[model samples]
Target: MTAPTTMPKFSKENSERRRIAKQARRLSLRVLIVCGAAETEKQYLEGVKGLYRNPAVAVKIKTRDKSPLEVVRYAAAFSKSDKDDFDEVWAVFDVDEFDIAEAVREAAKSNVNVAVSNPCFEFWLLLHFVNRRGHLNSYKQANALLCKHLRDYDKAQLDFANFQDKIDIACARAKDIDETREKPYANPSSGMWRVIGQISPGSHA
Candidate 1:
């Protein structure tokens, strides 16, 4: 009869190191953000990631110049295909002339989070400076309002530095609007604060 093979034993120090490594991996969170715009949203989110610089949180952004519904679908598919890779998946888009009902429904079905800025994303940026309750008719109108605060505001480029310190204030303002409004995605409202809260949990606003 063959002698029984003895199992190699791990030292206590080695076992402790293994346990710590597993714990660290468990603590880390990986996030994927799918944007409907090609530039501005990506720029702003990259800035948020840079500001936090949280070692345990990893953020990845993908841009698709598609409709909000399509963007949400893509994010959902990607999440499904690589479910193990990301702890959470988010879809960010504007309600600019597009019927966002389907997109919102899809996000809910796929368990994807959303950051929607009604009329335009600039409306969210505008909140960082001022809390205006007026309805925004179009992207141009929101951009114009944002320009009042960020004189050099441009859709092609974004300066995260301008909005960095004002994050808390912006979140508070957004929450106030959300609380008072009957519709969640009402004009001049933004769900961006929700995303910010997740990426930067320390945000009090």
Candidate 2:
């Protein structure tokens, strides 16, 4: 007589995990972020994505060392070309010396979102530690203020862990400053919270 074969037992935990992951993928929101700076903005965004680890949100970052207006235009073009790939497209840039009024208008017309940090993106990083309302004269000023909070702050290399736990506080501060602003590109303001909210809704809430 042939020996009876034993069937392997299936684990419920593994099956449940697979089901949840599949559901998350089905409900995922694909987002594309176009950055003006080549490093800082990209690195910060990547950090935000990593911190959230939200399977329901997919983020893609593209770096371009260009003016605010040019960045917006490029984002608009990409959004149009890859309409099916990205559910949302955002242009991240600094309100440096660029004429941002036209870029903002263009973004609106092209259905592209904008995250403009006045002086520089470092202003956004600074908000994670304190609510600074003073006007920043330039990127260097913002960078210096951020360094006060993060003693070893570096533009080329960012440490997201430093700001991870303070994300909610940063969003609140940024929102407060934005609400009081008469212009979207007002100094010492950061629109970054808008996009961050979408990536991790719980953080902004």
Candidate 3:
């Protein structure tokens, strides 16, 4: 007969201390990004990483199925897992039909962050090309606009390389939209820039 072993409890204090130490060593700031879909967000972050290529930052992206809530739940769980030690965890989701309040609440409780887009993430990408002034009600609508610029764009392809030069513009535009719009109804809005800024600290693009 074999006896079962108990898992060690995670200590936030210790985690914080280790994170600080890691930072001091000039090591990469470990970030875990959980996305709702398989490609778009993943490719975009990957491009961000490639663009910066900074020794001080590292981004790891994982994808989930359809639910934004489920992605948040996964982020919460991943943050506490013993196998990984991350400085921050973010859930990338879109505000479509799903009510994101619960996911946001749960993420707050678990110390997980969320980068959400209204309509869809493509709208966030579109911000790099166009300063959209109106509401985008669906992902398809956003995609159509984006397609005009990226004629061959497909959801499976990240194509962030094409927009790398315009990141600052996208950031500024996203900021403007966020500032001008109303809460929970801010169409064509995204909180992605906040996370992107953190991931690429000091690098404006």
Candidate 4:
């Protein structure tokens, strides 16, 4: 037999330096979505990556139907690279009637603040609407009152199920996007990043 091939060893200091470099590039308030399937997560991952950089994600189970703790622990470990690298942690998973909220609360209690996007499947699509054009915080209850807005604007046929699409349609129609109304600079007053908090009621962890 040929000589056994050994794994390349990395010095601890070198590994730590590389990790610090990566942490510097990552954003604060890192989000982790525990989507149900690989294919489904991949679809939403692509959409999220289109907007946010390197937003992490995971699956609903800990491992092969095991407890959720396994995965939560993994996520927690991955996030603690430098301890101060991120400000908040988001554990997003579909409401599976399995006390997911409690699980998330426990998982996040030790390290940082945590939030969850209930009905996680749609959380992916929700981001497409709420966070892309604007942060969700600027428009609270918009999802609930979307039909009313449409009616008020003489577009009564529209519905909340299609609310995000309609908003995007409106954005496209406005062509010149009134910076005064829908700014994209992360400044709620100027850009389209104002939809962070107001639009998503389905996300609570």
TM-score of every model? Answer: 0.85, 0.83, 0.82, 0.36
Clashing pairs in 3: none
lDDT for each candidate structure:
0.87, 0.87, 0.83, 0.37
| CA displacement after TM-score superposition, residue 61 of candidate 3 (Å) | 1.3
Query: lDDT by residue for model 1 over 155-203, one digit each (tens)?
Result: 7888888999999999899889988999889998998988877778553
Decreasing lDDT order of the candidates: 1, 2, 3, 4
Tens digits of lDDT, candidate 3, 1-205: 8889989999999999999986754566778898898888888888887887766666778888668889998987877783557888999999887888888888888888888998899988999999986877788899999999999898896677788999889989988877877774377699888778877756422
Off by over 4 Å in 4: 1-37, 52-68, 81-84, 112-205
Candidate 4 lDDT, tens digit per residue, 96-203?
A: 334554556666575523222332333223333444334333223333333243333222221234443444433332223334453222212111122222122232
RMSD of each: 4.5, 5.6, 8.2, 12.9
For model 2, how does the per-residue alpha-carbon lDDT over 23-78 read when each residue is reduced to its tens digit?
Answer: 76557887889999989889888988988877668788897789888898998888
Poorest 10 consecutive residues of model 4 by lDDT? 185-194
Clashes of each: 0, 0, 0, 24
Compare the candidates by TM-score and give the number of the best one.
Answer: 1
Error of 4 at 7 (Å): 29
- Whose lDDT is higher: candidate 2's or candidate 3's? 2
